[model samples]
Target: MSEWRIYRGVREPHDGIDRLPDPPPWRDFELSGEVTPFDRHADALGDRRLPRADAYKAEERTIEAVNTALYLRRPLLVTGDPGVGKSTLAYAVARELKLGAVLRWSINSKTALRDGLYQYDSLGRLEDAGVARELRGPTNGGPQVGERGDVVAEDVAAAPASEEAHSTDLGRYLRLGPLGTALAPYALPRVLLIDEIDKSDIDLPNDLLDVFEEGMFEIPELSRVADKQSEVRVRPADHGARITVVHGTVRCHTFPFVVLTSNGEREFPPAFLRRCVRLHLPAVDDDERLRTIVRAHLPTAAEDADEVISKFLSHAASGELATDQLLNAVYLVSRTARDGAPSLDRLTALVFQHLNVTVPTES
Candidate 1:
């Protein structure tokens, strides 16, 4: 493991990321050591319950693929069945290498490249502008007069400055999305999980090629006003965090470690595939692997899980069932048994149902 692995997947967090060699010339970016405080978005990113570092188990092939992607500074396209740890792979790598929270971009049918990059609240800005205008009087330059014909001195004094401040504050309405947050100028690369790419719009994969190739993106709103305001500080995808954008552009200090998961729902273009390192995760069918996973996640139930595991494997042999489903069954059975509840057989049956099987209705 010491020979070539930068990310040793033994479920132990380490500073091995520091040992990573320089990337290929084309992949190198200017380095910045500036540190910024940020709140981790683990909960919002849907990885709040990540498996304990001491519990996750990674296969040799998966480790090699991760390292290859890391050294080459390319995205890893992981295709596998649901609940087979495709998304968890990103979390595992981040845990082992001590990378900060994983930035996730979950895709849906309507997901576009910009959805992962940044979002500008133009409507919010416009509404704010309207409020500012109201604060200033109808005369275009003075405060509103009361019914008694007296001047509103406070409104007059505050309105012009408030309007000026709000009009120039573009950062208040702009935010960097997950992908954009991953490209922040950090000394160490952040781990990024682009989940379910197969569900994205047709053009998204091709759209990502340029960003992955150049390691930078531009915020058009900021770009247009770069001369007026050379720098803008905006919030990132993570909560309560801020990052600075210079000249309306963001260039990576290091290319993020990107993992794109797919469920084999669609095919990607050859050109897009050319830029990614592909890895296919094999199904977890063996009892030893299943037991290891069970122990990792449900240690209290490990002893009682054997019978449940056997039943799950038997059912899985005939139809599709996720690994999580097995864990769910084992957890319930173990809890019920301790509570002096009824038969484990019935509980297992309810929990281990096949995912791909559909029930027929009688007319």
Candidate 2:
């Protein structure tokens, strides 16, 4: 068995599942369900949980952890094997609660916490400023009525910036990533999917603590110019929309619903563990695995699907194969079943082979 990195932090287990309140009152949401969550995609859900959804059969412990995270306004750290639906948990919750779209921030070895927050385009803003200066041609006139209506005549080069020009504040040059978008103030809390957190740098998780705890952050550029500008409409993760931040401060009305997924490839720090509600996802029973396979791939699969599922289950017992591989085998078999059994026993040998497993040849 692989070594599970032991942490020094005290374990904070989830209490009963009913501890969660009926959605935080601080957030702005159209109440619908018993505990309706903030949904970004209200139109997509349309009074339904999820349109194209399959049941996520998680154990009671896992469900309890989700509820606990929601109640405490903390992030959930889910660790499990690859293709074990760790990332899918975020989508499931968002759908179940009728929350809007899931804001996902996929992490990698080089991913930094700041990248997920916001990006300021200083160079681009500088270019735009230069263009504005160029657009103002030489005009020397004062208090003249033009054909359009009452027009102020002045030297274009010497004239002050218009209201539109002033509207382009420091925040206009900013684009919030998924993390920043989730943290942005909204009527309802957004479901933030931090996928593959284990692949991030060692410091990324620790860096996120301040934001998680405070439920807000500041843009240094915006902060510097805050005295000059009281409110700045900045672009967030969503396009064609702007969020007003006063004094360059963006605070969450409701703490974002964060779901951090890990593949158990690496261990997180003790401090990081303490801040999160962690859940260890285990492999499901073979029958349930087959059901997932059918739900995803062969929804119309005939009774013969059991034979292919059994083959996958057999290999899964002895080797390291993901559930997706089983789904793949089932899809191929069911699609071509009309042509007769086309060497499924032989196909499983090649189709379900694990990357690290070595199978001996006929000797």
Candidate 3:
């Protein structure tokens, strides 16, 4: 009857899905069965997994700026040195909002619009067309169609041509790129992690201005079909159209919690800067660093985690390595301890070996 994008059933195709913990309380919720609204995604902010800013020795102003931007639905442009948790903001927001995090679009010189959207397989399309012709050919006993009393060849040929029916809409099959998918109207608040935007070309940030402003794109390839044009809404993530054909107009959803991270490597155009809320993520101190380590690696004893964190931070302050690298080191060490795979003694050796930190040998 009506054209619709049917979401595949929630069947687990991998071991990870099978081993997933129970759905969080929010996941069980139903807002009139129409999917939860966007605002609901932010409701979990109060219970974010990270420790409160107060508990850490971090820049209170930076934390405040991030929170304010989230509450205000403004785009946050955070600039800092590499390895300084510039990208962690996205993860923190997702955890707080209870929505899953979509991360770093390692944008490079060649990355384009289609790279982020759903992939359209043209070869697959041709194969299907060939299969249809073979099956419906006269030798294969194709179905007969008739008006009232006679079997007409033209009627059979035109009988719901599946070969022609395959969608050619480049926009339709275009999977929502990370940024696009996050902005789509969904039951959840999407946390779009545009990591290392500084690495992107000069025109990339400027290019995004329109979509960031309007919140949507149209795919003519997918939406050119007469059947879809009349009925399908052309919404991303809906009806399997990752992109939409612009028969008319396209618009963006207003509140995606857009977060862009930069290493202060390049300056953005004024026009792009004006559209976003910019913040500087300053270096964190010992107390704050320890706090993050404890929060993420807790149940492994704060004292042990602190000891490792202290050493890494000491090295970072000396400019031996960057803060982001230290955080990564701590996370891995804590994970090592938590998983019961190693002792602090062994982890200390591994951390020094893998990270830039130095571990004083036994006396």
Q: Local distance difference test, per candidate?
A: 0.81, 0.67, 0.51
| Model 1, span 51-149: residue lDDT tens | 543467888888889999999999999998878989888888877787768888999999988998999877666566557757664644533334433
Encode model 2's per-residue lDDT on 85-196: one tens digit a residue: 7877776676655456777898998999889989877666555554554565444533233343322122334446682353245665788889988877765567899999
RMSD of 2: 10.1
Best by TM-score: 1
Question: What range of 10 consecutive residues in model 2 has the weakest lDDT sum?
Answer: 1-10
Q: What TM-score does structure 1 among the candidates reach?
A: 0.87
Q: lDDT (0-100) at residue 85 of candidate 2?
A: 70
Winner on lDDT (2 vs 3): 2
- Which ranges of candidate 2 are over 4 A from the true structure? 1-39, 42-53, 137-167, 292-297, 338-342, 355-363
> Total backbone clashes of model 3?
16
lDDT of candidate 1 at residue 161, scale 0 to 100:
70
Instruction: State the lDDT of candidate 3 residue by residue for 1-363, as single tens digits.
Output: 111211111111112212222323422222221222333233234434344211222345555665555545567899976555666666554553355434346677666655554344445444444465565554433423333322112223432455434422233323445665665555444667777788887778888887766666654434444354432333343223332334423333335667788878788999999878899976555666556546643544454456776776555565544554444556666576355577755654444442344567898
Q: Who is ahead in lDDT, 1 or 2?
A: 1
Q: Can you tell me which runs of candidate 3 are displaced by over 4 Å?
A: 1-59, 100-104, 138-157, 160-174, 226-228, 231-250, 298-301, 305-310, 323-363
| Candidates by lDDT, descending order | 1, 2, 3
**Deviation in angstroms for 14 in model 2?**
23
- Global lDDT of model 3: 0.51
lDDT of 3 at 83: 53
Task: State each candidate's clash count.
Answer: 0, 7, 16
